[model samples]
Target: FIMENCDELMPDYLNFIKGVVDSEDLPLNISRETLQQSKILKVIRKNLIKKCMELFSEIAEDKDNFKKFYEQFGKNIKLGIHEDSTNRKKLAEFLRYHTSTSGDETSSLSGLRLPHEGEPDRPFYYITGESREAVANSAFVERVKKRGFEVVYMVDPIDEYCVQQLKEFDGKKLVSVTREGLELPESEEEKKKFEEDKVKFEKLCKVMKDILDKKVQKVSVSNRLVSSPCCIVTSEYGWSANMERIMKAQAFRDSSTMGYMASKKNLEINPDHSIMKALRERVENDQDDKTARDLVVLLFETALLTSGFSLEEPGSHANRIYRMIKLGLDIDEADAVEESTSEPVAVPKVEGAEEDASRMEEVD
Candidate 1:
C-alpha cells in the first residue's frame, strides 16, 4: 500500500514499508504541514511496531525460516534493539548468538532464551571476551555451563555495552556472570568457612596488595574460582575484562580516561587452590624467604596477565622469574662474575690517492 500510494511521493526505501497509512477521520484536504505533525504519526508508529512484533513472532515459531531471516538481517535487528527503546524486546527475539553449549557455530535466539532450573532463570546469560573461543572457554563461564546454563558468546566489541544498556528482556534480566556483583548462592556454613579462610589469608593478601603497588583495588578470597589459584574481577559498575580488552583494541584509545573507566581490578585468590593454600602457609612459616616473595609476585603478575591487564613492570616480573629459577638451581645470590669490557676496533683511515701521489713525488 505504501509503494502504490507513496512511491512517487517518497524515497524508494520508505516505500518498501508494507503497511496501510490511515490518519483517522481527518479531512482529506488537510494541509501537508498539519498532516505531518498530526498525532496520527505516533499512532502509526505504534501500530507499525505491533505489526513488526507480530511478524517476528510468526518467524520465531519456525526454526528454519527464522535462521534464514537472521542470516540476512540479524545485525539490523540487533542494531534496532540497541537503538529503539520501545521495540527492543521485539527485536531481541530475532537476534541469534553463538553459545558455549551449541558447539562453536552460531545458534538461534530461542535456544539461548529458553529457561533451565539448574542454570540461571534469567532470559539470557552471556559472557564477552576478546574472541568467540575466549568467551566460550572463559573460566568465569565454566561453572555456569557445567550446571547446563546456556551462555551467549559475545565476541563483538560493542556487545558488552549493548547488553549493559539492555538490562532486561521480556521480564527476564540479562545477567553477566563475570560481573563482580554476580549473585551466587551460599549456605550459612559456606559463608562462615569463606570468611575464616579470608582471615587466614589476610596477611598474605596484604603483602600481595602492597607489592602490587595499588594496581588492584583490594585482594579477597573468592568462592567462584574452582581450579584457578587466582583471577581478577572488576568492582560493581565497572567494565568487565572483556570490555577492557575492547577498549584497548581501539585505534585511538584514550589511555588516561580509559584507565579510569577500566575499573581497578580486585585480585581474588582461591583459598581452596593448592597455590593459594601453599602461599598462605609460606607467608606465615617462611615469610622471610626471598623465594616465597618472588612466588607471590609471580602469582600477581600471572593473574594480571590472565585478567587481560598489562604488568606495570614486566622487567621486574622477569627478574623475579629468573631469581626463582636461580634459587631452584641452588645458585648463590651473591655470586659475582667479572665484567668484560672490550673497546671497538677502529677502522684505519686510508690516505687519499692525491695525497699519496704528492708524497710519492716528494720522496722522488
Candidate 2:
C-alpha cells in the first residue's frame, strides 16, 4: 500500500475509494519524508483522479448504476465543483439537474448547452430554493417558462456554493431568474411594446416606488412576469432567498453581515396584469389614495412570499389582509374597539374579610 489515506491527494468526499495503490516507481521503503515530498506520488495522485473521472464518465453512460453511484457521491461532485478548480469543467459536464422542462428527469449541462456563437451573450438561467416544490412554484419563472425556456432548479443546500464557482460554462454565464435586470433577447416589436408600457405606467411606477420607498429599492415594470402581479427580486449579485435562509439557519452567522448580505431587493409589477391596470387607474386618480396605498403594500408583501422571502413585517401584512376582508364584508372602516359592556364585578365583602382577619388576630 502506498499510503492508508489520501485525503490530501483525493477529495475528502472521495475518501471511500479505498484500494492498494501499488506503484513500482515508488520505493518499497519510502520513508515518511519521501511520502510527504515525492514528485512520483503527485503524478500518481493526478493519474488516479483522472482515472476516477473516467470511471465516473463510464458510470454515467449506464443510467441505472449511475443513479446509485450518484446518490452516494453526487454531493461530492457538487462539492468538487467548488473545491476542484483543475477539473471544474469536466465535473460540470457530469452535473445532473432538474430543470423546469425536465419534469421528473434530470439533465446535464451538456444536454442543455445553448449556442455560444454570439459575443458573450445568452446566459443560462437557474433558480435556487429549499425544495423542488419551492423552486418550481416560484413566481420568477412565469415569463421565462412562458417563452418555452427552461431553468435549472437548484434545491440542495450546497447548490449555491457550487454554483458560485461555476460562474460560467462553455462561454455562457449562469444567472438566477430571481435577480433584477434580467432581460431576455426580444424582437423589436416586443421591445417597442415594453417601452410603450413603461411610458404608460410611469406615474404608477412612481407612486408604487414612493409607497414602497423603505421596503424596496424601486418599483418598476417587470420583464419576467406574464400572469403574476408583482414579485420581489434581489440585485444582480445579491444573496438569493435560499442562501439567505441557509445563512440565517446557521448558528454562528454574523448578524451585521446579514443585512449587508441581504442587500436590497427591487419590486417589479407586471404591466399587463389586470391588477396593475386598476392600480394604475387608482394612482392616476390619486397617488395618495388610501385603498391604492393599502393594495400596493399588500402586493409587496405577497410578492415577498411569492419570491421566497419571509415577511419582515408580518403584523402589518396581517392587518392589511384583515382590512381587505373587512372591505369585502362592507364593515364600517371607522368602527372603534368595543368597550367591555359588562360592569366590573363589585369587590365581594373584601372590607369585611379584612375586619374579620383583624378580629381573629386580636382574639389570638
Candidate 3:
C-alpha cells in the first residue's frame, strides 16, 4: 500500500524524481506493479498532484523564483500541459513566452494581446521558426509589426505544437502570421484603388498562378505586405511552413499522414512593389515573353525561399538564379564558351623506337 501510494504521488511530469518506499506489512501475492492499481493509491495521486499545483501557483506569484524554476523545467511543464488534459488549463496559466513587447524579458502568451485603441483587432499573433532571430526576421512579421501587432516569438521545436494544442487563450484566437485569414481594414478610396490595381494586375496574377501551379495553390495580390515584393501563406486549415518543416524532420513521422496538413500554399504578391508593377506591365503586354516568364518563375521561387518553405527542386532554383545573373551581366547563353584544350602534344618519336620494337620482337 505504501509503495502504491508513493508511486501514485509522483506525477508524470515529475518522473525524474526517484525514491523507494519500504514497509513490512505486505501480502506475498501483492506485487509492486499490482499495488499501482489500488483505488486508495489513485486518491493519493490526485491529492499529491493538487498539492503540487498549489505550490506551483504560489511559486508563480513570485516572479523571480518562478522565472528561475521555469528556466530549469519549463519544457517539462509545457509537455505536461500538452499531455495532461485534466490539468491543462492550470498548467497553461503557468506558461511564459518571449514576445516583441518584452524585448529580452518574457511574458505570458495570454497577457501579450491587450485591447488597444486605434488598432485592428489584435488576434494573438505568433511567428514560429527554428530560432528567435529567424522568427523576428521573418517576412511574415514585417507588415504586421508595422501595423502595430504584438507577435509572440516561438523558437522552440515544441512551441508550434503547444500553440496548436492551445488554439486560443484569454478570449483571443492564436493566429499564426504565416497562416491564411489575415484581413486588414482600408478606407473606401484605398479599397477602390486596390480593386483597380487588382484589375490591372489580373493578367499578372493569372500568369503567376500558371507558372507556380504545382508549387502553389494560387497567386493573388497581398494585403499583408508593406515592403516585401512577395510572401507565402498557408491555407486556413493547413500547417504553417514552420510546422511542416518540423514534422518532416521527425524520423518516425509518416509522410503519407502529412498530406492533408501539407496542403499547397498561396503566393501573395505585393502590388505596391516596382517589381510587381514591372511584371504586371510585362505580363499585360506579352505574357508569352520568355523574360517575363523567367521573372515570374524567379519571383515565385524567391518568395518561396524567403517565406520559410523549402524548395522542391533546389537545383532548378540555382539554375534559374544563374540565368538571372547571366542576364544581369549581359552574358548571353552562347557567350558561355567551353574552355579550349591544347592540341595533344605529339609524343616525340624516340629515334628508331619502331625499329627497336621490331628488333625485340624478332629476338623473342
Per-model CA lDDT versus the true structure? 0.71, 0.84, 0.78
lDDT (Cα, tens digit) per residue for candidate 2, span 159-278: 989998999988778888988888787889999999999999999988888888888988888778987899888887779888888998899999999978884889888998999999
lDDT digits (tens) for residues 1-364 of candidate 1: 1223533222222223465565435322344322333455456656666776788779878878888876776656666666677677766766678887787557755556465566455556777777886666566775567655678887766577668767876667877767675555567998899889888888988877876666778887777777778887887688887777677789998989786788668888888889888878887886767767778778878877776667778999898888878778888767633435667789887869779989999999
* Model 3: per-residue Cα lDDT over 114-169, one tens digit each: 63665535578888888888878888888778766788888877777677678777
Question: What is the full ranking by lDDT, best candidate first?
Answer: 2, 3, 1
Per-residue lDDT value at 162 in model 2: 98
Q: How accurate locally is residue 1 in candidate 1, as Cα lDDT from 0 to 100?
A: 14
Give the clash total for candidate 1.
0
Better of 1 and 3 by TM-score: 3
Q: Name the better of 1 and 2 by lDDT.
A: 2
Task: Indicate the TM-score of model 2.
Answer: 0.87
The clash count of every prediction, one per candidate, is 0, 0, 0
